[model samples]
Target: MATHAKLSPSSAVRWLSCPAAPLMERGKPNTANSYAAEGTAAHHLADQCLSFGYSPSDKVSKVLAVSSKGIGFFKHDQPNKKDIAFEYEVDQDMADYVQEYIDLIDNIMAAAKAEGFFEQALPLESITGEKGATGTADAVLITDKEIIVIDLKYGQGNQVDAERNPQLMMYGLAALNEFDVLAEIESVRLIISQPRRQHVSEWTISADELKAWGETVSNTAKLIDSLDETSDLTDLFAPSEDACRYCKASAECKAYAEHVHRTVCADFEDLDAPLTVDDAKYDGDTLAKMFERIGLIKEWIKAVEQATVDKLYAGESVGDFKLVQSRGGRRKWLDEEQAEATLKAMRLKVDDMYNKKLISPTDAEKLKKAGTLGDIQWNKLQDLIVKPAGNPTIAPGSDKREAIITNPVEMFDDLTEA
Candidate 1:
């Protein structure tokens, strides 16, 4: 078996939605991006802080490197495949965000300990009987009646909710399986601490509910394994925005392409027909439907464009399209100090070469928290802070913010003023 499972918990949402995704994504190259690398680095920092009971700020200025063998706080000289490695510097921003996650864990631990004897579990490994249904949890705290499994999401993209989340459910199942022997666990609390988004989401479910979900997971795994090389997968794949967002085969998947086509070119008679603007007057209902599916459509378009570019780069022809140089070269000083010195030697004015701007209100609040600004000064400055009314934009009805209402009297007053 491979070290990483085919039905990994991280990809649980995708695979569970599109049952054939694991098989279809075979041999697809999994490339790394800077965002993923940074997230991994943040996870490593959090792990270190939790393990050693040190502040994330303590690791500031330290380099976290990843080689082919695996990630670690190692030197750059470590040999690896293709001499390839990624390094991330521990910065103040990352430290602050990770400290929030650590603080959340500490708070949970304090409360759990107050209740009774609580045992903390690190690196909760999967012990499931189902093949390829393994995962390792970030942290797990087990008490007499409850188990808390916390997952730290460093990505600042879309906010991740914890309710009925497959990844967290898998982690909850693993934690229960690993530590239920020690404690009589009744309920599992899954927490997703996304410090980067400044959002923490949690959900609690009974232990029996988690085990029942586990059985469904096992059945899904069995369904996935039953597929042979010659089996038809037409009905096996179900594509949706969340499921197809990170699927490796999304670029070339026929079902996904068809889904996007239908989503964008709705009201058309033929699903495979070419799209044209002729007689295309979309109704309000049609427009709303398209808007809802716009994210998936945009993702599919981006994936197709990237795939074309990759093929072109690999000496393959993508119709009449070929790679061209883009207007992306923006020059910068190679050495800031040397450039400044040369500029000064040329009699350049200091004010002409430098920019001075006021710190933002947010940063000022940070200074106040850090004790750099006195309470009186901060209070005085608070009077100068002005927040403009946000512009109205489209949002779903489920949004927590109340709808902005334009009062008829205020509208008449504005018109009179005008």
Candidate 2:
């Protein structure tokens, strides 16, 4: 009998969200990063150990015994293709870190067991669909009450929440049919585990809702598959600035390259605009103040420019800025070493004076009896002194850090509040 094809939620989302992403993923099977591979391996091992009591073989287990303590690892079948090989020298540190991660898996599994809602977890399974469209889910949890699907993310980007997840629901639909437990499944729970941050987010939806989501995914996949070569698919996937970071074809994508170039030119154009001066109407004090303001503005502009250059070199964002003010003249401060030496010569350790405490009669008696004030001992101290707070001295064209506006509406409300 021919096996029926299955369409997973992950592929569906990629296909729907960014048609280009799925194309790239399918075309490049071995292009996944180490983090992605590690996450997959960890989740595979976890599901095996939790659901079927299958642990890693002794040799693989030994390798994992020393990995990162917080990260986990388990060996799957060796890759059919080798990417790289190492010489036969033992690296004890690497071995230990690997084992640490292996142990972390045990800890995570233990916690999952303690929760006691699920019966067994299953590792990755290929969900084949029509026209060669297919994908694999990280893991699936079988429970008396519900089916839970999990996706492991090694990246440090935004957390994936289930309410918006199409992949988990796709897994739910496939699993429900494959297990013949459509009626038994009360709901489908999707979880995203971010190992680096040690965080997990779960979203749950009813079986009916999952089925509906699956249909939507199927319809989307069908739509993409149905498109002809002549279709102008530009509107199918909109170009986004965030996608530029990891998009495989970003360098060659005309939309992305043009967008970036356009933005850069626009910014330069804005900066090059002429600055006008109106000095004819000013008189005496007004003229002097205006001149001073212009000087200050010039200094501020210099500072902002320097900051922008630094950020650009550092691969950081310098969104926008306007000059504010500049201070005049030189400033000096006492050297820390000189000040500390002088204070020591006067028979005073900075800590002693800084932490001197006056106790009440009852507290004093307690301290004397104890030969110490238990909680009064200064454990740690550091000095943070700010001087000349009005304006900072900086070179020309130096950029200053700009403040961010988090909630414009909230700020407006606050300003108008009675």
Candidate 3:
């Protein structure tokens, strides 16, 4: 099986817009963290459920080993692989979350069956198109007239939408190309299932539209493939918030840094010059425009800081900065049992030996998910859960949230009263 495609559908948004990203990101060390490993485990859990005809609950408490090789299954007790990143014991929370995704697939399967679409496939791994490009559709259901490609976004950081989503669109194109011979595929439906975020978004496009988009994708891929390591991609780079958010090369890429500089500095000729707030340029309209780029600027700043730390750790000199241990670390018991026994031997009271506190509402919700809390009991508990109004934050006009209106007169009166 292909480990990862050069122009993978998962990174279509990154490459399609910023064609230079593929070459720029090549050979960079992966910075994946525990969250990524957890996501992989969750996907493996979902796969096991679908393939073995078993619910996630059935595998509760089972050990899931995630490594550089792949996810380990049964008999993973004694894994010989030394590259094991981490092993996750399937908990009720994980099982329940994976079950939500399974439930979505089950519902889709049932609906497809009703529509006379009996043929189905879990994880269309060989959905190849544009020569070197490929994608894996989490689940696919097909009929004579329709094809459904479902992708599961295990991450809950940003809410993914199906509307004009390039990743799902690429998946749709790949799925259509792969399965067109099996049926008269007229329409392709792209679905993104994000169980943790309680989001399931889907969009449908005609086969003609999907194919047309695929042609554009093919052209971009061919152009990128034709470029060599020495090729200058000055014009090919397109920097945006979504495209640069998870980009591995964002910190070091000259083009990305220039883009950020241009965005925030605004016509400042020296891109590498130190940033300073020019009071003369702080007009109302200019400030308003700058606010839009604030998020991107913050992301770039964070990326640069992280890159500096990573370089220092790798023994690469970055200016005069040196790595040092952080001060004021939290304390932990060296041996909890031994400490408890010693406390008991000293005739310490139970209350004195241990600290007890009520669990938060979030913990109570976990109990509900684990089936430890019944519906009625959870409902009663929820009555005590208070959610205060969030402070107003700025967002673009296109944001779905209602704009908070301010009353200067009422505010002044309230301040005076206070």
Please name the candidate that would achieve the greatest TM-score relative to the true structure: 1
TM-score for predicted model 3 compared with the true structure: 0.85
What would the per-residue lDDT of candidate 2 be over residues 120-198, giving only the tens digit for each residue? 2222132233644334555555656566666655555555556666566666666665553433767777776665554
Q: Model 1, range 250-299, lDDT digits (tens) per residue? A: 89999999888776665544445667678566887656766787788888
- lDDT against the true structure, per candidate, is 0.80, 0.48, 0.77
Clashing pairs in 3: none
Give the Å error, residue 280, model 3: 4.7
Model 2 has an lDDT value of: 0.48
Against the hidden reference, what TM-scores do the models get?
Answer: 0.87, 0.46, 0.85
For 1-418, candidate 3 gives per-residue lDDT tens digits of 3345777777888988999998889888788788888888888888877877888877888888777777865364575757777888888778878888888878877877623121132222333333433455677777677888777788998788887898778767766777789888899988888988888888899999988877787788788888889998999988887788888899988877888877766534344566666643666676677777777788889899999998898999998899988886789879999988988999999999889999988789878877899999999997799989988877667557799988999999999999
Q: In model 2, which runs have C-alpha deviations exceeding 4 angstroms?
A: 1-12, 20-30, 51-61, 64-134, 156-158, 180-182, 241-246, 259-418
Error of 2 at 193 (Å): 2.1
- Where model 3 places Cα greater than 4 Å from the true spot, the runs are 1-3, 74-79, 112-133, 267-285, 360-382
| Candidate with maximal lDDT | 1
State candidate 2's TM-score.
Answer: 0.46
